[model samples]
Target: MDRPAQISDSKLPPGNPWRAELRATASLAWPLILTNLTMSLIGATDVLMVGWLGAEELAASSLGFNLAMICAIFCMGLVTASAPMMASEIGRMAHSVRDLRRTFRQAMWAAFTVMIPFWIFLWNTEAVLLFMGQVPELAAKAAVYVRAYMWSILFFLFTLVARNFLSTLEKPIWSLIIGVAGVIGNAIFNYILIFGKLGFPALGLMGAGIGSVLTNMLMFGGMVLVLLFHPKFRRYQLFGRFWRPDWHRYAQLWRLGLPIAVTMGLEGGIFAGAVLLMGLIDTASVAAHAIALQIASLTFMVPMGLAQAATVRVGIGFGKRDPVWIQRAGWTSFVLGTGFMSVMALFIWMFPWQLAGLFMEGNTPQNMEVLQLAVSFLAIAALFQIFDGAQVVGAGMLRGLHDTKIPMIIAAFGYWVIGIGVGAGLAFWLDWRGLGIWIGLASGLGIVAVLMLSRWMMRERIGLLPAQSLSKR
Candidate 1:
């Protein structure tokens, strides 16, 4: 619960701005990275526990979970609006307690407002899955899981908002601590509920879903307790007017958040869509694609955390009306993120077989096919890892400037038009199969990365900087 200095980056000593920015960004980023990793572990635990039930149950839960995540990840992105907004406030005024509280409140308001309709949609998961041509039995089982897991979204989104609140204030260690606790709790709950331990009835997928709900609730509850009692955070009084109306701020949150949500959805959807394309190739491709994608995603957590840090850092610079500071902060994160991914890409390139084998091992014909395909996919994934990191971190940099509308449009064109369109044409028409899909994905990410970077470079020219910052120049 250490308190960050009540000073902005614009006030940093001039002799070594890059080093200072790097240190600041790294310190803020590592806890957030560990926090993200821990959250991922929570999901991994659920998948692993449900997997033990049987292949059918595992597949059903995966369907239900992925569907829920589409909505959940979008909502999470929406609530993320609070981070940059709050960070800017902090930069504008060292002690922006009331402003930060207002943002947090509106973020929570926005989260609840957006999640209700999604809850209704989740309740009808079976019909949706059936409509999508999933097996009827699997769809039915998925529906059961969705019914129980949907309730977790609200708490999860709330926890995310709370995490942003802490991150903006540079006190994200609690988030990591709570997330680690949640990982352990989720595993234990899944074991008990899924296995009918301690007299609990074996509810199968239903139990796994319930375990998710309970874990999210506890996570959110832990965040609440920390905010209420922690000396560093209590001063903000984030919940002081929980029942009060702040329509202006609430609307503002939506304006800023909606595009971000759509941007994130487009990125997330393309990957989900890639899975569908893999399914068309064959079950083996789907399985192999899963392994490669999982490794890519796990490695991605590093850049993702750096991206979050960039948003805060650049947002602070934006608030101070210091374009120089903004550039320094953004590029520092960009280099760190891309540099980390380059190393990851090289490792994946050098050890694709070893990494793929971590998820699947055996020399049976089916296993070997999966292993070979996974290695192939990872090879392509390795090539694009840097671009993938660049695009995400680039998006983060722009988001800090509150420039999301155009990025949303770019994501649509890149992910859907170039990414999916090219992939579909190549996989089916060109007959390159899964490898074709991977190339298309790489193309999309590279295009988006270049576009995003161009925007950042031309930010001043394009009038993205604040009026005051431009005037100051």
Candidate 2:
């Protein structure tokens, strides 16, 4: 007779404790970290390359890109629902290899289905830019960039699905590799196309968009090729016969994904709305807000990577019915996130000018005024990073527990009802301008941090896990 497998308590170390957890977490986190950083670098490169074209081009492209990102952020959140589900399945070891393949295939179809409409909308984006109050010339330029970028959505979505699938399998390194390669490819393409190097036409701002599209396609192709031919993935029938669409599973994914989409959309919408609000103030204020936002974006990658790790760890613990491990994962991630942001905030506080100079050095008088405003805003922004980090990791823990909808609601209220409302009041009524706006943001994020952490704590105290799977019970 075959021997039965043994399962141990989640906290019962197999041999070593700290070393083991560190290894496990690092194994999952490093790739995610690299992926996040590379993704940031791609955005930074776009800004840098387009900045060369002219200030008007840079500003128009930035605004248009931010608008496009609001859409992409929502779509990304919907697709990210796949990560926790896949992680839980892997943790349970319940699915057959073929089943895993089918899951990924369905995810691709879902992503494609969602992206196509958005892509078509973006393809005809000139009207949208005009509607947003762009002048004809700037609107046309923005539309050209958006139109080029729209072509890459399908490919980018495919790569995202693949990356999420790997993350579920505790194989984030593959994502890191592909992300780095994509960044390199993007940089090379940007250099050639943006500057008319190597017989390429100098397309200016349009070239940055084209580079992004080309790199996305390459990344998608690379991921597909790797998954299809790699020996490890080959056993899973990754490229074998396509299964017919399973409506039940599809519905399940959509139900879980929709709230996530709304949550991300709300968050992105707040920032996009801020852009609109800033525009009403002055061009210098808009530029200042943009600089601070970009700086915050760079710092955000650290928490985001930790959050991804938290999702995987919590999913695994929940799958094993190990409440203690689940709690530990959440708290550990929170602590790590806090520590990382603390250090970053210190640096920003110490060298505000140095940091602002990255995007503002040697610019016009208007740009210099914007940089000064951004520097002043950094103090408030820095304080808020702690709360921002905490809330995101808390949300990730909730996602691991498959508790998404409530967090979505919390984010909606926190960002729209509280943050935006307060910021608008402060900016217009209080006449605090940028300072009032950031203060309002801090208040909203602080409330969200407390609420999310409280919810996680309550769930842990009750020894409750999500009801999505059998293992949670």
Candidate 3:
């Protein structure tokens, strides 16, 4: 069942694979960058708003949100399977997988199904914190916050699904627009609820949670509205026959997604564990670590966005079984991601103090102690960005190739075995403390970056590419 070329190969510009892939990927990635950045800004806004509430409130909100995000993000990674899967399917000439309705419906089912367990955990947040040995009072406060924030996951997952769906269809601008709208909505909600404006109660930490809920809801609702009314989207009839179940599609998504979930969890868990280590040292170290980690995360969104775009780009090649296209897309993304992170590393190196100052109180003696520590952490974070960007983009490239299971193993071993082992040994045994943990992070990311890159380079050498004949669509 060979299909003719949908777009003529001659349509490609004359250039080396690097220039061609760079142009293609960047075209897809720029809007995605804005979308991802907008999401991060929403989080930064929550942190900023809660900071005004009080120290205890801020601490509880941060800890509680982190706990929630750990579970939520892992599931989000699962949902991410839709990107590469849909990309490959859409690249197909066959009608069987091209409609996208099945993928959309199945993704929604998967999200809701996963949300059930998360709901139970969020509701029992206090018990979980207690079992984890958190302070009783802190656990109680966090519980209240989690209870309110839990409902937001449904909306959050919805927005993600819509974003991935549209993005794979080459409609990233829609997600970007919705995300921008979300930032505005989030700010307005926080101002009204957190400060008790418009005759609303000043709910403080819980208010922040509510603001988040409203932001996610607005994004999801906006996307849905577009899908319904927009002529382009309406053709898909996404909402038509929405109640039907497709167990096979659901299982396929889960099979592809579960390894991604564990892969993301292992990567995120390493950083969370590093934070726990910081806590053991002192309050100041923990505060400094938080500020530094936030900055790292904000910057990481760049490569993360590019990595997502890479998955789509690579997946298209994989679907067509074009090894050349796959290799080109993979390498171009790697270069661009690492190059960008390199520039960022320099920026952080020069302005570490300035960056940390934005988050700190005025430069008092006590504040200076934290400022210094954060500066040090930022320097280390700067070093990690290069490797981190490479590792993440490598992972995304592999995901596009439908190569998940081995990458998951590589990530786990790199993060837990090499990363944690080295950091724990240095911090606890040799007493380098926080700096040691930072070094550990850098080490893990570097090793994984190398391993993932080698896997990609060796794909043909190892006979990993699909052997079936491929033709254009």
Candidate 4:
């Protein structure tokens, strides 16, 4: 079986394998990086727009957003399992075009099945918030936001499926383009609805949620249209006639996706737990934590993007039976991701106060306190980005190798046992405050990164993986 040209020839030029590897990595990574940064900006825009409504509003919105994200992030992780599997299949060309189309239909159906019940549960968001012990007013507002956002779930799931399909097809730029457009639409809609601009009624927080929903729908619609009409996708039978669900492929997808969901859910749960514990301190402290979390999330996008690229590259490489190329793709992506994040970290460190001010206003005593604490946290957060990047990319590489269960366990141990355990003990028991919690997070991510990367390196050395052979399909 012949391997795809992209992976087999991805090696460095005669004298500079490292440089070639870096170039290859950058080729796949840059677009994703840009897309991530843009996505971050969208989040920043949301925060900024909503912050004008006042601190409680901002806090409530952030809390609601995080709650929704907890579920969405886990779902995204589950959907990502498709990327590696699809990439491997595409690289090897193992399945007929018909089979590929049927696989995608089944994947979409599977996603729909999972999301329907999830959305139903979300419809009673206030009750859930109450169970989670949120303030009454905050819970009410959150419920409204959740209900508005719930309408977008089907579209969001579709977008995820489409993005994964495009990514596996090695057309990530399309995903980026659609994301950018969605952000633009979100901003526009938010401006009009949140502030009642352009003759619209001011819906406040609900406006933001509605705007997001509309943007998602628009993006998904556009992607689907492009996929159907675009010559490239058409030539590839990207949306050929749909077929009945194949239980075998459906089960395979579920098996691969479930661990990913658990792994990411645990990670989200740990962070959410940190937020809960932070609330034990004071509203101001929780606000500061939220701000810092947002900042850290921005920095995380770089590595997240790199990890997505690594998943595609490595999955394709593995399918082609080229161990060396797989190793090259993984390492090159790791180095590039690390370096990219390191630069972002330096910027955050140098301009912590300025950056913090972006989320805090008026320089009042409480606001300034949150801002100062956020700056301090951002400093620690800068260092965490390196490990964060490494761990995510390592996981991506492993996903390419179709080795998800072990990585899922590693994430569980690192985040739950080590990260949350240490953070909770320090923050509550020892009274070390917010810093204590962050220290635990950093430690957990660092350990996970080293272990995962080491595992991938060892696997490559043993030749247990090979480049995907396109002819197999």
Candidate 5:
């Protein structure tokens, strides 16, 4: 909860900026890294819990959960618009309690406004899934999950807003604590509801969804309680006033947030689309794709966390009109992301079979095939890990600079045009199957990495537009 001092990089003694930047970056990044990883654990545990129910149930749960995530991701992106703006306000002027409060209020209204439609849409997606040509039985089961997860969307998006609020305020540890608590709560609830433990009726997938929904509410409540009670956040006076509609602030949030939403949708959708494409191959392919994707997603959380930190750091620097600190923060994040992914890639390369085996039965022929395909996919996943890390961290840096439009376009083109197109051609047109599809994903990520990095490299040409934007405050 410490108020971040402005322009500390300048006053520091010679040669100290490197260590200073590294320390600052790591301090902000590690808690977020753990938070994202722990958050991801909820999904992992759900998959593990549902695995006992059979492949159909597992696939249904995965499909339903992922579909919900597409909306959730977009909502989170919308909330993300507030974080950098908040951080910049802090760095630009030490006492920005009102600005912070206004952003938080607008964000709260925005969260509710957008998430309701997503929940409703999710509530009625069985027919949509069928229209997509998914298996009838599968679609029906997934719909049960869709209806269940819908209840969680509002709380989940609010939690994202709260997370951005706390983290950018230098109270990230609260969210980390709440996230861990949610995971623990989720596990206990899943055990009780998924298996009829502790006298609860066994509702199966329905139980899982209910458990998740309840956990989301609790997590959001945890954040609010912390903000209300915590000494450091008292100055903001966030909830004291009602958050009436403000079209100007709402427009500001939208213009910045919408492209981020689209960029993220394109990035996340390619992976989801890959899973569906795998579905076209067989149930085994779908299952294997899920397993491999789970592992990759887990590792990807590290860079994502770093990227978030970069956004905050870069935003602050931009607000302070110190492009030097901005560049330092940006490169520092990229290096950390790349270095961490290298280790993850090595680990995946060494243990693909072992990691893939954790998700399925080991003795059966069908499982063996799934394991092999999963291992193959993991290899491709490993190849792209660094690129994924670089691109995401790059995006985070640009976001910190408030450079959203071009990056969004770059991301969409790379993921959809290059990645999915290549994968689809190889999978369907060329008949290269799942492996080809994974390669396509890798190609897309690689292109995105190059484009984003190049953009950051040429940021001098992009100039001080981010800093200029802050003067309007």
Candidate 6:
């Protein structure tokens, strides 16, 4: 079977394999980068709008959003297993439409499976927060936001499946278009609902939640329509046999996806823990942390996009049993990912105040204090940007080879033991407060980056590669 022009390496310029890989990786990465940016913008817009309600409101909403994100990110990691699975199948046989469809279908099933329990957990957000030692008042307000926002999780998961499908097929432009539209739509809805514009009652924090749910529904609906009708994607019939089960593929998804989910949970959990920690410190600390974290997260989206691109590119190489291609793909993404983040680090370092200003307005004494703390946190984030980029991309590269279990362990130790442990000690034991938490975050990311890159370097000796690729080498 002839591979499609996009999947075949033969068309790469013969005399410059590195340059060819660079071009290929960049072409796939840019749209994904933009898509991730736009997606982050949706959240940032919420945070920005919510900031207007007051510091306590901002803190409460941030807590609610972060808590919801911890669950969503884990579930997303589970479904994302399909990306590498589909990419490798495409590499092995370009026209493996049935295999692709089954993988996608099972991934959606996996998403639905995980969403049920999370929804139950989110519905009782206030109880959980209080149990975790959050202030009763803030917890109650957060619950109000979460109850409305939680409904978006299912829609978001469905959209992720569709986005991963398009991304694996090397057609991520559709995701970018949809994401850009989502940002605009989300902003408009948030304004209308939160501020009570256009004859709608001002719902405040709850309004932000409702706006997100509506935006996610539209995005998911748009993605399904595209998959159903787009000439290229329609042939796969992703929704065909919607009720059928492929037990083997479903099991495989769980096997591969569970570790990925755990890895994401460990990482996202540490950040959520940080928010909880901030909540303990003070309302102002929680608000400042949210601003700084949002800025860091926005920049992190670029490397995340590169990481996603790396997963697909390397998965394709793995399918072809081509170690050299895999190396080229992985290394190309590493260089691009780290290089972009290095520049962003400098920008953050140089302009922390300006970046912090984007999320909050007015220079009242409380705002001024929060602004100062945010600036300090940005400095720490800048220092860790490269490591953050490296670790995420390295994880993506390994994931392409279907090596997730060890990374899960690595994340467990790095994020919780090293990241949170060090952070807690410094914050409380040493009286370093919020700044200490930021330092701990940087430390964990640095450690994880080194470990992930080291593992990638020894992939062959350690048997991370598929048996076929090892034998081929």
Best by the TM-score measure: 6
Rank candidates, TM-score, best first.
Answer: 6, 5, 1, 3, 4, 2
- Each prediction's TM-score versus the true structure: 0.94, 0.91, 0.93, 0.92, 0.96, 0.98
Models, CA RMSD each:
2.2, 3.4, 2.9, 3.3, 2.4, 1.3
Candidate 4 lDDT over residue span 262-321, tens digit each: 778777777777776675666666677888888888888888888888888888777767
By the TM-score metric, which is better: model 3 or model 6? Answer: 6
Which candidate number maximizes lDDT? 6
What number of clashing residue pairs does each candidate have, in the order they appear? 0, 0, 1, 21, 0, 0
Quantify all predictions' global Cα lDDT against the true fold: 0.87, 0.77, 0.81, 0.77, 0.85, 0.92
Candidate 6 off by > 4 Å? 1-10
215-312: candidate 3 lDDT, tens digit per residue: 99999999999989987677677778889988888899999998998899888878877765665665566667777888888888889988998888
How far in Å is the alpha carbon of 456 misplaced in model 5?
0.9
Name every residue pair that clashes in candidate 5. none
Question: Tens digit of lDDT per residue, candidate 5, span 1-473?
Answer: 34664434444457788788888888888999999998889888888888777777887777777777788887888888998888888779866788888888888888888887887788877886777677778778989877887888789888888889877776578889999999999999888998999888998999999999989988989988988988888667778775466678888998988888888878888887786677677777777888889999999999999999999989888777777778888999999999999999999999998898788876778778878888999999999999999999999999988888999999889999999999999988989899999999999999999999999998877673454644444
Clashing pairs in 6: none
Scanning candidate 3 in windows of ten residues, the lowest lDDT window is: 1-10
lDDT of 2 by residue, 304-388 (tens): 8888888888877776666756766777788888788888888888888888788766567867787798898888888888888
Of models 2 and 5, which has the larger TM-score?
A: 5
Decide which is better by TM-score, 5 or 6: 6
Q: Which is the better candidate, 3 or 5, if ranked by TM-score? A: 5
